[model samples]
Target: MSAPGAGPALVLASSSPRRRELLARIDVAPARVASPDIDETPLPGELPRDYALRLAEQKARAIVRGEGELVLAGDTCVAPGRRILQQASDADMNRRFLELLSGRRHRVYSAVSLIDADGVQRSKCSENIVKFKPLHADEIAAYVASGEGLGKAGGYAIQGRAEALILWMSGSHSAIMGLPLYETRLLLKQAGYPIG
Candidate 1:
């Protein structure tokens, strides 16, 4: 058996730099980052809440977790009502996403999953509501032109310049940025991972 303070090394099942940076805020660095390749297509009629959690779990389990390694994964999505807004793949898509979100309240669901060395899977979800101030054409154009929203869920990075456009927000800002530090800490504690 390992020493009382010893624990399995952490493996992050994602390639997202935001997630890595977020982990750094809590001073918990993963021993390795394993990018999981999985189909992220949502099931027909799936709700946004379920979609985020499912993706997180799947991403976590997709990694070939080696012995003595605990895998952590997370997924974030934007949804207005039941419609899940996918990550913008291009400038046009990004502009459209921003246009849709303008002056509207939307939900950002961030879900986290952890698989411990003992193979116990634990998960949590953080749902945040955010409303953006009405965006002008030039503002949206400039934002889209900046290319920060491309490839990001909700077509905006809460931690970036997009923050200036936010009129109201409730819930964990860390979650909206990508990972929920509070929930992540809880999962780490539950897994007996040392956290300072």
Candidate 2:
């Protein structure tokens, strides 16, 4: 199926609502949303930035051959120093992550990869710093109970109910949500997609 705007069919190799929403912000909706099933385990001694880029590229390449369509994939990671934080799957994990991030600065890395119709691949990375306010146990418990951190890297969503926990943030707000709009638009343009 073709996207609302006419062009070569574009495929988003991801299932992230945040990524889809960011794409909508640029008016470059995907013709298909295909979640590339790839193992996201970090490589031995792999830095967070490299890990994100590698995963993004792997995701795009996993779905792109002979499809005759452009494929876009992205990966986001949150790191506190050299430690990469995994997506919280339960309230206990979320609470622990929040505690770790309290009154501290962490980095969010978002990597995007685009494989054009010609099979030429291009990629970019976005990094943002976020500072969390000191949180009381009750506050953390409430946020965890809200269930907004599940499936989210860093145990928080800058665009969701966890917004109140942020003391300050420096970088692309969209990147924090999982996609960097500026870089995504550039990749779309390079893939010959029309963007307004």
Task: Assess every candidate by TM-score.
Answer: 0.96, 0.95
What ranges in model 1 sit over 4 Å off? Answer: 1-5
lDDT of 2 by residue, 28-124 (tens): 7788888898998888899999998999999998885555688999989999998888789888889999999999999999999999988999999
Candidate 1: the clashing residue pairs are none
lDDT of each: 0.93, 0.88
Cα error of candidate 2 at position 151, Å: 0.3
Task: Supply candidate 1's per-residue lDDT for 126.
Answer: 99
Best candidate according to TM-score: 1
- Candidate 1 lDDT over 21-121, as tens digits, reads 99988888888899999999999999999999999999999999888789999999999889998799999999999999999999999999999989999
